[model samples]
Target chain A: METRNLTCINCPMGCQLTVVTDGGEVVSVTGNTCPRGEIYARKEVTHPTRIVTSTVSVSGGVIPVVSVKTASDIPKESIQAVMDAVSGVCVNAPVSIGDVLLENIAGTGAALVATKNVAAKQL
Target chain B: MNKAGLSYYDIVIIGGGPAGLAAAISAKESGADSILVLERDRELGGILNQCIHNGFGLHTFKEELTGPEYAARFISRFHELGIDCRLNTMVLDLKAEAPSGDEGSSNGCIKTITYSSRSEGLVQITAGAVILAMGCRERPRGALNTPGYRPAGIYTAGTAQRLVNIEGCMPGRRVVILGSGDIGLIMARRMTLEGAKVLAVAEVMPYSGGLKRNIVQCLDDYGIPLLLSHTVTEIKGKERVEAVVISEVDENRRPVPGTEKEYECDTLLLSVGLLPENELSRGAGVGISPVTSGPVVSESLETSVPGVFACGNVLHVHDLVDYVSEEAAAAGKRAAEYIKGGASAGSDTPCVPVKTGNGVRYTVPSYIHPDKAGERITLRFRVGDVYRDCAICVYLNDSRIARKKARILAPGEMQEVILSGDELRSFPDLTEIKVCIEAN
Candidate 1:
């Protein structure tokens, strides 16, 4: 049996949860004060995923870059691959919030979308 | 603009952020006739415009949203209400009008707000009630007083956040952050994602001032070390930051001798703390609380001035914008009641002074009027330091009124204790309510 300690990010309380697994199967979950913690711990131990938020280069905009995020959570192990994909992207202004820049990033099936609007610079 | 140019409104909000927007909505819903929101920025959202990170609106919207998305929800509602708003306008001064005994009202004082913008040189707006939501600002390098040369590469964490997230400009390649504030922790991950090398994050306190989730996702996820009980002693560079000398600080926060270590870096980011912007409040003669550096207010959020109210960061720094919105909404409702003459005219009854006891930093709504106490009243406060397994106790004139068991309490997080008006009314002639923490 192996034990993995995790902090449940469901709420600001940040409950410290312990998940005991035997042969890659979650056996017991403890230290959770809420039901969501159980769901989070089970998923976290088996198939961890995280939403990626970062900035991308922008050209001819009032600002030099635009902030972007994965439309949905991606696999935890694919975070670096998703970030690498995001680093290579350069979106031109005028970019609007929720505008999809990349589809199926790093094969995680999550689109990268802009979170803020970047207006074009006026002459 | 002359006094004749003064536009009369039932309520005038001093900001256009989440707090102000929520206040305006509440006021309008409370049967307020006219409302206006004056924003200094070019757009509706304030700092939320540049905060593109997610984790917002989990409480209000029941789903994670980016800062801009969270702000847009309120902005849309504000527009739907057709509330009058002026962009790029800065309020210069606020003065209360002398009481004119005209109607059956007890105290009648209209507020005169002086504001200026490029379009309108200077305009004085009159309102039956005013809500102060100017928010707070980040503590700068000057406040730190470290032995450092004035350098171009040094920036406050919030300024760097605006530059990178909004302006899309990289401040530097290599970075060292000071103070471990929430903004500083968020920026550490931001800089790393932008391909900038983040060497380390240092905090003078043994404990971190940021949330544990941020420490996990921002620093730990990126493999950056957080140096507790450490601080930057000096900055080395004439034009830009070249290196920073860090030293371990004793418990008393004094730097120890012969413990200096140098790290080569091009940027230094300070995320020390935030201070409530209360110049407008002070100029208006509002009572200031030394503990909060904000306005001392009543349960209805009324300042010393009868018609002036304060909420949001201008009242007290809040860890979550959700609470700011809620508090501002309450202030708005009360201001509307004041304007409509629905609230009680005078306070003949004695008011209770809420005091902070051991381990308590400060509480919002510093005073409480027993008669006006609503059904559910929340007393929000922060701790001076970290404590585990503590019981937060509330005393009404030496009698235990309420107690809440906290699994853990940290200065970075805000704690709240709720009391019902019926319970408070039960204790007549109560002079004070003390909120404190005791070990379990």
Candidate 2:
């Protein structure tokens, strides 16, 4: 039997959830006040994922960088690889928000989209 | 418009950030005749322009939006409503007047705002009501008083953010963050993505001052160490930061002896805390709260000076911009009511003071007048420390009125409770409403 303790991130409440499992079979969930906490705990224990957000260098734009984020949550383990891949990527000016910067990043099938609109510099 | 050769407005809001923008829009919608927003910044979004991170507008827009996107939504609405705004204008002083001894005058109260701008020399505008939304400023290294030589490598977390996001310049190649503020955590990830090495984040508090999600996503995911109960004791550098000495702190946050650790870094980022920009409030003779560093406000968000209101970070430091918008809207509505002659500063109605009990820091809207508080009142507060399996309780005149169970609570996050006017009437002689956290 194994026990896992986690903090729920669904809201500001930050519920402290404890999940007890025996050989990968769920035994009990405690400390959760709502069903969302229960579901968060189970998914957190297995197949955890998170949406990655970062900035990419921009050329000829009003600003030097544009913020981007994964279209959806990606595997937790691929966070670094996704960041590594994003580090080398740069976009041009006139990039609008929701514009895709990378497709299928780190084999996670999540595209990186621009989070801010960067207009071209008036040179 | 009254007074010879003086520009007059029904409402004058002192900001153009999300708070001010939302306030102007709400005031216009609430039927204010004339409104103006004066902003010191060149743009309308304030800090949101550089805060490019996602996870904003979850409560307001019902969808995930970036900081700029969220702010843009309000800014667009502000323009759509044809609200008057002045950019790059700085308010130097504010004064309240009581209609110049004309008791029978139509205007009962007035405010004079002295401001300056590059294009427009010195200007003064009088208004019937004013809403303060000047926001807050990050605590700088000078406030920390760390032993260090005057160096160029040290910068506030927000200043570094503006440099990286707005100017597209790197503050340093190697960085050491002094506090675990949210901006510091987010900057850790930002600097890493921008090809900078973040050595570590040292926090004097035992717990991180940032949100748990930020800790996991920014530090834990990035493999950056968060040294809790530790802080930078010294900065060792001549021209620029070359190294920093970190030491473990005791329960009182004093550095312990013989626990010093050194790190070689070119940059030291300070994110110790934020102070509400209340100098303007003080200049206007507004009563300030020693705890919040904001104005002492009533249930209607009216400051000590009648016809004057305050909200947002100028009122209290909020964890979320969504709440700032909500609070600013309330202030805007009240300011509009004051202009429409529907509100008064002095009321004979009994007012109950809201006090912070053990384990809590402070509450906004320090006083509540149940008679004029409308149908409901939302009280927002922060905890002093982390608590597990705690119950947040509200008492009116020593009788428990509201209690909610929480699995965990932390100082970094602001919590709120709602009390309806009907519920407040239960205690007719209510003198105080205490909000406290009790260990379960």
Candidate 3:
């Protein structure tokens, strides 16, 4: 059995956790004060992901653009590719908050949505 | 008058941290000549030097970089612009010279700065405009009133970070960290990597104050534990830290009687909080924001006093160094404009006060000028606890100007929301802006 030391991040009590594992499966987790730490540790040791925020080009807008972010965490390694996909896309103005820009980005089941509204550029 | 001995500059910024350096660069770029930066430390990086962790620069640079790397990018530009920088100088005081009808010029601003090397005992400078960027200081154990015996192994999170990352010194063989701020969380992993056993991180708050990424990356990967609603009730040891008593806390944050548990450890690290260094600003009689504990400023980053500006951690605690540099650049550019006689054209409009309501601990830029054109106001705030699926709203006199949904909000990380001038213009008679958490 291999033992690992983890810091619980689910809450402020950064508990120094000890996870006992056999092969690839977790056996017994100790030192966690909350259930979130166990869930966090399981995901971290198996698969880790993060949410990404970036700007998308918008035409005919008062500000010429708006900021957007992924609705969910995507694969850690696929963030760059998703950013590349976002870099080439542009939306027309009159975009409102929570407007979907792209869905299932890089097959990560994450949706890119607008964070603010930008009026269409005046002719 | 000793006018011949004094060199007049358009703006003189004290400290060469990200804020001061950025201010100088902006002031110079905005066509203000005679701009000088005074840094007491030999290096220009400031607190960024001790922060060797990643997860910075996502907002401004669009790429993640280490703290020093982010600082180096700005320092390089500062050098390229040939901004006059004097290292090893400390600013003593700022005094107003004369009452000026023109509100933009800092001509009456005089600063008495002191520095001592092998040669010079002290030096001073007077300038047209002054920007306070002295940054902040970490809270120590004395402030926490920690019920513990005085021990040799207890250290602040920043001190431990400096010792380990900068000086390559090992803090201890076994560690117990108090508070779950970013520094504390990072140090837990640092000590573990250095082959030390971290017993636990105790937090008085019900939630973690650090970023979600740090929680996962620093703690989960290593199997560290976090105890919510728990705190270190007592410290045990005489000459050295040998053990700490942990207890569960109730809603009132008082330790419960029967939940006490003791763990043996050799080191205790505190990462409680940071307070802004605003003595210079206060000495100059600049109005301070109760929320930020910094200067209250308009959209142009000008403080309550004319010709004075503030930015970086001095303005408000920031989660990312990139934003600090970004905001500092704005303050720098505006200071330059003021020196060049190109300040915004208008009478000083009365500012509406902003307050923190539910869930938010505090908010920066406590005052707002609705008439300012194209000015984007950034409100930096901290939540009171750990909240998930919460909506943060900015309300102006009962009207919701902006609202954003957050998946998680922790006290450890600072949150920022920008409101454009166009939004402010919609409510011409705006009396106040109140930020509060709608749901958690």
Best-matching candidate per TM-score: 1
True contacts kept of 1: 0.54
> How good is model 1 by TM-score?
0.94
The candidate that wins on DockQ is: 1
Indicate the docking level reached by candidate 2: medium
Per-residue accuracy of model 3 over B209-318 as CA lDDT, tens digit each? 77666767667656788887898889999999989999999999999999999999999999887788888888888888776788887777888777788899898887
Model 3 is docked with a DockQ of 0.04
Clashing pairs in 1: A65-B168
lDDT of 1 by residue, B1-440 (tens): 32566678878899998889889989988988689999999888788887878888877888888888888888888889888999999999987766455573434777788999999999888887889999999999999889867988999999999998877788999999999988999999989887899999999999989887788778987899999999999999999999999999999999999999999999999999999998988988889999889988888888888878888888888878888888998998998998877764356756888899999999887888877887978888999998888899999998987778888898988888987887877897788899999988
TM-score of chain A of each: 0.97, 0.96, 0.79
Q: Can you write out model 1's per-residue Cα lDDT over A16-89, one digit (the tens) per residue? A: 89999999999999989899999999998899888898888889887788888999999888988998999899
lDDT (10s digit) by residue, model 2, range B1-440: 56557999999999899889888999999999699999998789899988877778889988878787788789879988999999999999998867766783434767899999999989998988999999999998878889979888999999999998777789999999999989999899888877899999999998888887787668876789999999999999999999999999999999999999999999999988899998888998999999999999998999988888999999999989999999999999988988887767656778889999989899988999887788889899999988888899999888888889887788999999988987786667788999999977
Docking category of candidate 3: incorrect
Q: Looking at model 2 chain B, which ten-residue stretch has the lowest summed lDDT?
A: B100-109
TM-score of each candidate structure, all chains considered together: 0.94, 0.93, 0.75
Better of 2 and 3 by DockQ: 2
For candidate 2, please provide the TM-score of chain A on its own: 0.96
